[model samples]
Target: MRLSRYFLPILRETPKEAEIVSHRLMLRAGLVRQQAAGIYSWLPLGQRVLSRIERIVREEQDRAGAVEILMPTIQPADLWRESGRYDDYGKEMLRIVDRHERDMLYGPTNEEMVTEIFRSYVSSYKALPLNLYHIQWKFRDEVRPRFGVMRGREFLMKDAYSFDIDEAAARISYNKMFVAYLRTFARMGLTAIPMRAETGPIGGDLSHEFLVLAETGESGVYCHKDVLDQPVPGEGFDYSGDLDAAIAPWTAYYAATEDVHDQERFEREVPEDKRLHTRGIEVGQVFYFGTKYSAPMKATVAGPDGVERPVHSGSYGVGVSRLAGAIIEASHDDDGIIWPDSVAPFAVGLINLKPVDEATSAAAEGIYERLTKAGIDVLYDDVDNRAGAKFATMDLIGLPWQVIVGPKGIASGEVEIKRRATGERETLTIDAAINRLVAG
Candidate 1:
């Protein structure tokens, strides 16, 4: 993509309303624009990153044996009523009325609706252990929606619903999602610590929230430091095997959010040196709600003994849009968002330092074409802007690498390659630079 023809609206100054680092950086980088309190219009740049994050989520969910199926943003109010939560969900639920005067709502979550779908067609244990998921927009009218997308009124989410015949099978489904979440966050360059959490309105005895530690986080967390270093389950991990063993290393450490934190137990379980108490942002959560919604909504399947019973169920959710903001919070520096390689909108930013100079423009275009042809995403800044402004813009957007092509470098038969995470620069021949990035 050429910046000259792009739609980025980079802000010159930080917005006063942005209280957190991610919100401020997101505004300045022109990733998103607020249309109302907590409501945002994801601009082109933001959309790219959002799509990348959603793709990673989908990949992991599929790897864990969950099938994809999109659900509607608006739902019938009667579905929630059937689950006995129509009124109990409170003010956050955006209640609506249709032209026919029938009750409707912009769904905050999909438990009730998914249960209705399950009971409609799935009748017997033959379809047991089924998991369905979707990536879709959701809304909850927050009383005080702030901190940009972190606590937005409207956001994108990846929600997966798992159905099994009994408690034991439901636990297996839950464990699959647990391992999936760990791998998902790790792929995006985040070390997410899974901590025991309150099920809240979801009403589950078994629940875990995956949090990424950040000073500006909404909740305080206590965990063993080793939880941060535990390796994620690799790609070849057997999903059909005992997933408990795969997650044992992470669960061995005591971790809990403030809602469930036990100070005395934390101290007893972890040595002083191994204890880590800090603020953290929640990125995802998994729950085994048993028959919470299924029984109430009559979502039953026949057992092997021919007895009809409510199917045990679980819900797994990842804050798809909130993760963009969370990633910024966890990865940025003073400059701007330091996007992880997997979730970066572009792998490389090609800056034509002297867009007006024929040599520099030609060199940049050449490198951009080569990278793009090699199936790399590259953003070429071919606009007629000052070198400092170009550099600032590149750093603010935070692509993993910046390939600088100035007249001086071109004259010397070399180009400058700079790593965004570290301010390390290497001057190499154009061919060498291209080879290095391609090989990476």
Candidate 2:
């Protein structure tokens, strides 16, 4: 994407309303625009990042054996009534009524709706272990929504529902999602620790929240410091094999959010030197709420001996859009967001230091074409902006690699290569620069 043709409405100065670094950088980088108090219109750059994040979530979900199926954002209230959460869900639920006086709502979560759908067609133990997932927008009426997309009222979410015939089978399904979340976050360059969490309105005794530690996080968390460095189960993990072995160490660790924290136990179990009390951002959550929604909503399947039984169910969630801000909070420096290559808006930024100069433009254009042809996403600075402004824009957007093309360098048949994260620069021949970036 060329800067001149792109709709990058970058702000020259920071917006006063943005309190956090991600919020400020997002505004200054022209990634998003506030449509209302907590609602945002994702601009070209933000949309691209969001799509990349969604794709990772989708791929991981598929690898974990979950089939994809999109659900409606607006759901009938009858499903909620069946699950008895219609009145219990409280003010965060956006309840509504359509013409003819029928009640509806913009779903905050999809437990009841998914249960209703599962019961409609699935009816046998043979199809017992089924998982359905969707990536969609959810609305919650946060009375005071702030911190940009991090705590937005309307945001994107990747929610997956698993249905099994009984407890043993359901537990296996739960573990699959547990490992999948680890892989998903790892692929995005995040180390997410799974901590036992309060299930809130989801109403599940078995629940775990995946947290990414950041100083500016909303929840206070406590855990062993070494938990941060534990290795996640690799891609070769057998989903159908014993998943308990894979989840055992992660589950046995001493970790909990503020709502479930036990100070006395923490003092007893963890050594003083190894204890870590910190703030955390909840990026993902999984729940095994046996018969909670299924029984109430009549999501039953026939047993092998021809008996009708409520299917045990579980729900998994990853905060798709909030992750963008959370990632920046955990990874950014003074300049701007330092995006993980997997979720970066563009892999390489092609900066022509002298955009108006013929030689620089030609060299930058040639490199951009070569990179694009090699299936790389490159943001070319083809606009007639000052050298400092171009460099600032490239750093602010935080592409992983930057290729600098100037008249002097082009005259010598060389271009500069810079890694955004390390701030390391290298001068190389034009061919060498193209080869390095394309190979990368």
Off by over 4 Å in 2: none
Q: Write candidate 1's Cα lDDT for 330-386 as tens digits.
A: 888988889999999999999988888898888888999999999999999998888
lDDT of candidates 1 onward, in order: 0.94, 0.92
Candidate 2 vs. true structure, TM-score? 0.99
- lDDT tens per residue, model 2, 80-113: 9989999999999999999979999999999998
List candidate 1 segments past 4 Å from native.
none
Using lDDT, give the best candidate's number.
Answer: 1
For residue 303, model 1's alpha carbon misses the true position, in angstroms, by 1.0
Report clash pairs, candidate 2: none
In model 1, the number of clashes is 0
